[model samples]
Target: MSEDPASSRQSSRNQDKTWINRLMSGFSSEPKSREDLINIIKEAAANQLLDDEAVSMIEGAIDVHERQVREVMVPRSQMVVIGIEETPEQLLPTVIESAHSRFPVIGESADDIKGILLAKDLLPLILNGTEDFTLEKVIRPASIIPESKRLNVLLREFRENRYHMALVIDEYGAIAGLVTIEDVLEKIVGDIEDETDEEDEDGFIRKVSDNEYVIKALLPIDQFNDEFGAKFDDNEFDTIAGILIRAFGHLPSRNEHVEIDGFEFRVLYADSRQIHLIRLTIPES
Candidate 1:
């Protein structure tokens, strides 16, 4: 018997709707577990009802609620800072080198953080000449936050206050690190690279095809996970190079390859000191 094509297509769509309804039934009745919701989101993503980025964001939004400030802050040691004694000549060069909008002004030491410095504030020093450089005149009060603060709460404060950056403090009130609004939002929406961010000199992750990417070995592991929807353990390693070193038990030479979980990582450029570039492959299901 010949089936009517339009009727058969409509029937298939109806069956799909029924399946989706069954999956969502628990959400309205007894309530679905976290795993159930995650599975449902994944199923929706696979069915093209939601995009991959949207799925990543949904998962991120859930995961971020459980995280605290310490999880995503840039360590104090890595923060770009300006010394209180820095001259206008020195300050301008330092700001230009860092390419950051704000810098923590330090007093005698890193522990003695004075206030926040806006790079644009230095414009007056340049425009009027470097005769007088009073950092106090240009300083904005720093926002101090405890390292234990929940990300969701921090996000609300950021939105309400219009503050872009904050200094993270320990229980003893010593600077632990720093967190920016962008960092918190990145937890929910993924890496939000600005136009001013310099492109990776070695070539950052480039999509060559649907399931393959040519990446710089120095690319941060967290950034990679956000882009690819993969969960690689990032507790001990920061970069793809770090992962390769752990996998090989030594620095990997060019063309060396390793497969962890389901993704394949192949070295594209390297030296004895570091891995430079890599090719990543993920087989489509």
Candidate 2:
């Protein structure tokens, strides 16, 4: 009338294989669920965590997921391209001030993107006595992408294809803008400091008043620290736009507003699906 003690004992003895089950589960051999695999890998990675790499990788992934090429593309209105018949002397200033390493060489309109020209090419040509240089001779092949393509994909393509510049195309197959590898990388990392940057303790841009505000998403963390007179680590994000996106869980649209660390973010305007223009209002530092 009692349970089988010997059978139960043998079953318990066989239970010695539980660790094997767990080991196989780690490799997901038993048709396990999603969390099992995720948990196993996550735990393993956590156990062998590398701080700097993990931080960079995490931020990189977050940055990659949140960005679209359209957000960072140079709108057609601002594009600087060379006409097939244009002289170099007239184009040098435009190219120099823009600080772009390369630009698309096109006809009168963006639709005619012929190729890309390196800004540095002008220096060598000028030094080499080819002052009448036409971009048609020096232009390199250009890569094109859809405006809807995610920034991550664009970055990957740029690397794999070994192209530095891209022409952003809209759904109608018209050039909407341009994007460079630098622009795409800066979206994930912070701005690459150049000699042109002016470091200020009050931040690069600030609010003059409540209704009118200034913002420099490139404002350094030290400047932000001084301006706000607070200590906050910018580990997860670098730009104000990144912070806003994280807070909103989506792009901030026209007139949308959110407050963070005593600063107010008002979406002035953005391109169709991304945050292009934002006004951050903060007290004078």
Candidate 3:
């Protein structure tokens, strides 16, 4: 992803200023006149200068439509789907097992999805009636996405439109998976947990596939360094994102992969040159 022409020119000006700042990094003696440096900075900013930091942010804006739900999804394997004819006894157990508050009701499998069901909706059925309970009556239809929509755009879509989940589709446009508000939020602010969430030393991280993990970026960087025993260098970056920009050499589009510390970091959403959303895949051993 590249910046707009106006923004690009501004970035060029900013890059020059970075060089100026760097040249001045270890100065033992300050410049004789403060006006010289002040004019340079004022000129750069007045011209709308931007540094590498500006590029990271601009890339997020340019690459919005290219990410997809599957890239940042709660995969089907981890999904909680129930058949339309599923008995309340069967339904209750699935809900309890997942500790999820919602379920998708389908006629046969998840592909034949009829609607979504919230656990609270099941409360009335739990105490009194299993006899007339049907999965179809309690589900909601939601917006869907292809496995190619950009996470940044999706984040805006989610925010402006207030969509909670988007059903991910394959090229043929059938549902291949789903992404939730939590899934998108995980990419941005990192993982979130509730009362029922399980705690493993591997705690809270959901292992959806062999290589893919739903983990919180907030988990201490040192913790990852210690746990995974990786030799990742965090020179100027404190989070996974700072490291990502260092690798790509520029801001990247959504779902674009780069190998770092033996794992593939896929951009889910990046706002302001920072990784607000991402999908991590372990590199092949």
Evaluated with TM-score, which candidate comes out highest?
Answer: 1
> RMSD for each model, in Å, please?
11.6, 9.8, 12.9
Give the alpha carbon lDDT tens digit for every residue of 94-158 in model 1: 78887899999989988888899988887776479877667877889899999999988999999
Model 3, 65: alpha-carbon shift in Å?
A: 10
Worst 10 residues of 3 by lDDT: 55-64
Q: Please list all clashing residue pairs in model 1, or write none if there are none.
A: none
Off by over 4 Å in 3: 1-78, 96-101, 140-166, 179-204, 234-237, 283-285
Better-scoring candidate (TM-score), 2 or 3: 2
Please say which candidate is ahead in TM-score: 1 or 3.
1
Ranking by TM-score: 1, 2, 3
lDDT (0-100) at residue 258 of candidate 2?
85
Ranking by lDDT: 1, 2, 3
Better of 1 and 3 by lDDT: 1
How many clashing residue pairs, candidate 1?
Answer: 0
Q: Would you estimate the TM-scores of all the predictions?
A: 0.68, 0.56, 0.54
